[model samples]
Target chain A: MRYAYYPGCSAHSTARDMHESADAVARLLGIDLVEMKGWSCCGATSAHQTDRVMAASLPAANLLLAKEMGLDTVVTCAACYSRMKTANHEITSSADMRAAVADAVGQPYDGSVKVRHFVEILLEDFGIDKLRKRFKKSLNGLKVASYYGCLLVRPGNVTHFDDPENPTSLDRLVTAMGGESIDWPHKVECCGGGLNLTRTDVAVKLSSSIVEMAAASGADCIAVACPMCQASLDLRQKDIDAATGKKHHMPVLYITQLLGLCLGIPEKELGLSRLMVSPAGVLKALQPASSHQV
Target chain B: MTIKIKKQSGKSLRQTVEEMSGVDMSLCYQCKKCASGCPVTKYTQSPPSEIIRRLHLGAGDELLESDLVWMCLSCETCYGRCPMDINIPAVIDALRSLALEKGSKSPRGDMPLFNRKFLEAVKAYGRSYDLSMIMGYKLGSGSLMQDVEKFPSMLAKGKMAVLPPSGAEKKVVKRIFDRSKQAKGKKK
Candidate 1:
């Protein structure tokens, strides 16, 4: 299946591991993920914080590009997916918004282009049964806490994503890969993602709480679809330890990274070493660890 | 902080906010579901529901003076759970724009500044460059040493991209920013 991929700013920067692993998985699955060239940032929360129309306009620039490619758009960044979905919802549902967005984009913006997160594509478009058949190894004993941080599955009406409170797509994917996705309470908890840089103090508390909850639920590692969630949960352990006076190092891997590991793809392709938290613990959990030395 | 209602032209803030956010604050019957699910309430003086109540009460100056608007993560937990379907995060965005426009003091401080710096980077590079935006925020806020210790590790781990994102149609992004500014201007 062919799809236009929009890797938002963080995908290549803070969450490059996710980008790398996702690309590797796409190659393995033979899905044609055409990169949306000339795409700009989604403006993240910065645009919407000032004006809603501007938020739509920024993503509209990228959305129009996907439409130009004549393919449904797919994004690895939850923020980009959310922004694009929200824009599409608004523009398709409201004639006035369509006009304003078209005006802002310097041309007619086709807001009807479909946008799906890469995970959605993997689960819905690329069926789990098909994916399971491709797995060379299994996440046999791995207990992964699937963290679907905000943006991916909130404001359920507009996003029409999985359940806003307790999304099961990530969990279901992990389970399909022969991993036990622990039923964690903080599955859809807010990690205060956008505030990570500006409000580091808040990020520490929220990120720490997610880690704590996952550890409590006996998750060996946390799998995330969103870059910001991976960044906050993976990068902030030191700060969390400093603030909360608790030693913690929970492996936060992209969902694709785990899939890559089970597919028996080369570890370097997934950028495993680039991760902040060492996944050594979880990597060892895979039976015949020597065979899958990541 | 519970906004002390000073007058009853209450309709003005409510009307402006509803028009800007496209959310009817009157739909809220103080269900408090938003407040119950909001994750950041412990860090702030007011919860998500209070923002809606304040808007309904037309707590203009008092509302802007507080730090509530700048604190919303836009996580949309409140918006999702609201039995009345009130988009509290949109209301928060309206409140944030209003606060920034009025140059009101932020109790928590530096969030709005960071937002401006972030947008400025997006405008310049067509994508966010971390180092530049941090430098910009440091210059504006003077908290130069904050988050510096983590920089070396970020670079070592390849988490930080030293250069601005390229290949973007910069002129197009600039136009979007400019037109949006004008869009808000024409509205006011």
Candidate 2:
């Protein structure tokens, strides 16, 4: 399966590990992930919040490039996925919006391109049973909280990706990779996103709640699909712990990184070392001597 | 307790919200379902239900002025929970856009400044340059000293790229902004 990959901004900077791990995992999975050439930003939360036209047109600009390539676009960032999918939804739903987007982008776009989250690609393109068979090292019942955050499943009509309330895609992925997906209510909770940069107080409150819930649920690690969620949960975790005066050292891992590990890819290659909260203890337990295969 | 409803004559704020958001404002019926699921409702002066209620009451610039609009996470929990499927985020987005247009004074800190800096980076670099965004935001937000302690660690960890990424899509991105502004100008 071939895809025009859209790595968004975080993948290049803060979430570089996610990009590297996803790249490695794609190679191992035999999926051809040719990056969409010189792909621009998806306008993310900022664009949509300020200007509607820019929001639609920014994603439309990238979608048009993918359309030219004649391959469906696969996005790793949940925020980017939401923006691009919403752009496609808006363009396809209304001719006026489509016309405006075309005018702004200086190109005709009928919203013909399909934009999919890479997690969806892993599920639909590579079957669960097939992925299960390829796992070299089973997670051996490591409890994982599949945190979807906001964008992956919310505003159901626009995204239409998974269940808005109770999404099981990440859980199913965790299960397929031999980990125990913990039943947690905060799976779809907001991580305070960009507020992590602007307002640390609010970000700390929201992030600490998420981390506390994951820890309280007995999760060894929180698995995320969005880079922003990863940053919010992992990078701000220390501050969260400090703010609450708790000793919860919950590690956050990208889905790609976990999949890479189960497939026997080295931790370094999966960008494990780049994680703010160390996954050292978890990784140590997953080694052959201490590991249990089911 | 008796509720004093301010009945206003002329164009309703509900009509303005509907026109701005393209969502039927009347679809919201004080169900409070949106407020119940809202994650940030505790922080806002008026939750989702109250925002819409005020809109129905023809409350004008006050709705735009409230910290509630800016505080909204746009997480769409309320939108998802609403049985009426009112698109609460979209309505909030409209309110935010209006706030930007009107330069409505907000008590909600530096979110608006941060958003503007983010888009300015996008407009300039085709994508967000994290270092530039951080630098610009710190300067614009007048808190250059806030996250300074984390910079060395960030650079060491490769979390912040030193150079801006160049892409062939930059020109087209700039054109997109110019064209959108032009289109909006013509519309007005």
Query: What lDDT score goes with residue B105 in model 2?
Result: 84
**In candidate 2 chain B, what residue range of length 10 has the lowest lDDT sum?**
B1-10
Q: lDDT for every model?
A: 0.84, 0.85
lDDT of 1 by residue, A1-294 (tens): 999989888865888888899999999999989999888999888888887888888999999898899999989889888998988887887778888988888898757888998888898999888887777777876899999988989878877789888799989888877789898899888987777867788878999999999998999999998888887888888887788788887999999999899888989999999888899987776653233432
Q: How accurately is candidate 2 docked according to DockQ?
A: 0.74
* Tens-place lDDT digits, model 1, residues B23-105: 87788899898888888889888888777777677676668766667878889988888888888888888888888777788
Model 2, A181: alpha-carbon shift in Å?
A: 1.1
Error of 2 at B72 (Å): 1.0
Q: Write the per-residue lDDT of candidate 2 for residues A1-294, one digit (tens) a residue.
A: 999998888887898998999999999999999898979999988888888888899999999889989999999889999999899888998888888888888889998899898889889998887887778877778899999999999888889988998999999988877789999989999999857777677878998999999999899999999988998888887788788999878889999998999889988799887888889767865744133433
Clashing pairs in 1: none
Local distance difference test, candidate 1: 0.84
Can you give the DockQ of every candidate in the order shown? 0.76, 0.74
Under CAPRI classification, how is model 1 graded? medium
